[model samples]
Target: MLAAAALAIAGVAYSSWIFDFIVPTGQDRFRSFLSELEADDVPWHQVYSYGDIVAGVAAVGASLLLFGVRPAGRGATTAVVALGVFGTATVADALAPMGTVPIVHAATSAIAVFSLFVTMGAATWSAFREDNWPIMRTLGATTFALVAIATGWMLGSDRLQGDYLLGLAQRIQVGAMSVWLLVFSVGTWSSTRHARRPKRVPRRR
Candidate 1:
């Protein structure tokens, strides 16, 4: 799922550059948001469209798998629900391209970001009761902090219309979220792998 997300983002970035839709090096960089690439006039817009669809599908499956396993605590359950919301919002973004449905696209994207924030917070809380969960908790906490700070900065400043900071904040939030999910996946995989060990057979009597 993380790989799909990374690739989709890469595809979008590449398409944006190729089409001159967002020249990151230019003065207009601050005004260049991700959604603009999804506009109808952009060249090769379908790449981002289809890539997000694939990523969203992958996210849905991954979230369900994570949720199905060991949902034994409130924090863990919250994480699961947040994960599902993240997937749903991702799919919603894919279905409603910015050009075709700008309002819906923006709304879903906002929800997705909120869901990701909750996911990390829940994971951090859930990790407190499990062995070897410190690393996961630390990761979750760090990611949450970066995103929260960046988002707050974006909201605190109106210069996003004229400065590059908003774009920087946006990338930081998105990138950190993806990295956090990768860490979560690895930690969960390790835990489940060790958790299912079978009992030793009784010695012959």
Candidate 2:
């Protein structure tokens, strides 16, 4: 279930790039944000909006599963709660369209991003404390750093040069999160699988 949710989140988040190849959105991949594809003016914008809704729902489900599977620790609890917030804010972002309600959209987007950062940071802390799944810990740290750098670049591009890199930066940020989620999902599945495996009894001697 968690793996499915992770896939849904990653897929919907990056599907804009796939749509770019097949659709004729008036928005530029470099200058425009992915949200532009879901704007009222764009063709099939409803699809993008629905995708966000699905992704957000999936993220929330994953958070529930995380809560169930996480080791006993406040860090793990924090991670789960933060992920739920991220998911909720993502859905709110979709509800408040960028074109119709730019201010609300921006606010929700900020909340989503901030919550994702908290989710990653707290998850990494929990992972290190557990002293297992080193790869997940590394991926969480890397994803957090990448998302921060890309988001900073996207926000600063307007002052530095232009908004040319805004879309690219946002894409990179989402991509990092997607990669981390994929790895985490797989790791979690593996752990659950191992835990469920039945131990064989040795033959009586």
Candidate 3:
């Protein structure tokens, strides 16, 4: 499901570029903010908006499954909430376009991005706690840390040349998160019965 979400996200992003719906995402002349694609009444922006909504909804399902698989774990709960927030933001973001309602759009974007960071942390901690999936844990933690750093740098570089890198930074963050989620999803849902089950909480040593 998370993979589907990632595909939906990438589809719209690529569509935007293919149709020239907005400036190319990573160029200096291009704005990094996803809202810009739909905010200014760009043509067929509803397509982009709805694409985000699809991604968000799929993520919500994946999160819910995580929650269901391990309701007792605090990490699972946190992941649920974080991804839920991300899903909510996408809906709110689509409803409030930047041009018609700048404040609402900005608020939703901030909320979504913030939730994304939290989601990464929660996912990393959850996988890292499991000894069986060493590779998954390592990749999750590494991606989480690196994306967190990039997000921080992007947030901190206000009014500087660093701001110019916002496009790249934002993509990096999204891409990293997508990779972690995709890999984690695949691992969790592996065809092997042993791998299909969620990792249970280890007993107290």
Best by lDDT: 2
- List, residue by residue over 1-205, the lDDT tens digit for candidate 2: 5544574565456344456658777677777778788778788888778877877777788787767776558877887788789888988998998888999999999898889889778778877896534556776577778878888888787568644587788778777776766666665666666667999999998
lDDT of 1 by residue, 26-137 (tens): 3233545555555667666666566556555655666666555656688877877887787778778868977788899989988977887787788788888634345676
C-alpha RMSD values across all candidates: 5.0, 2.7, 6.0
Q: Indicate the residue-level lDDT of 108 in model 2.
A: 97
- Mind sharing the TM-score for model 1? 0.75
Worst 10 residues of 3 by lDDT: 10-19
Whichever of 1 and 3 has more TM-score, that candidate is 1
Pairs of residues at least 3 apart in sequence or in different chains that clash in candidate 3: none
Per TM-score, the best of the predicted structures is 2
Ranking by TM-score: 2, 1, 3
Candidate 1, number of clashes: 0
Ranking by lDDT: 2, 1, 3
Q: How close is every model to the real structure, measured as TM-score?
A: 0.75, 0.85, 0.72
Q: After superposition, how far is residue 166 of candidate 3 from its true place, in Å?
A: 2.3
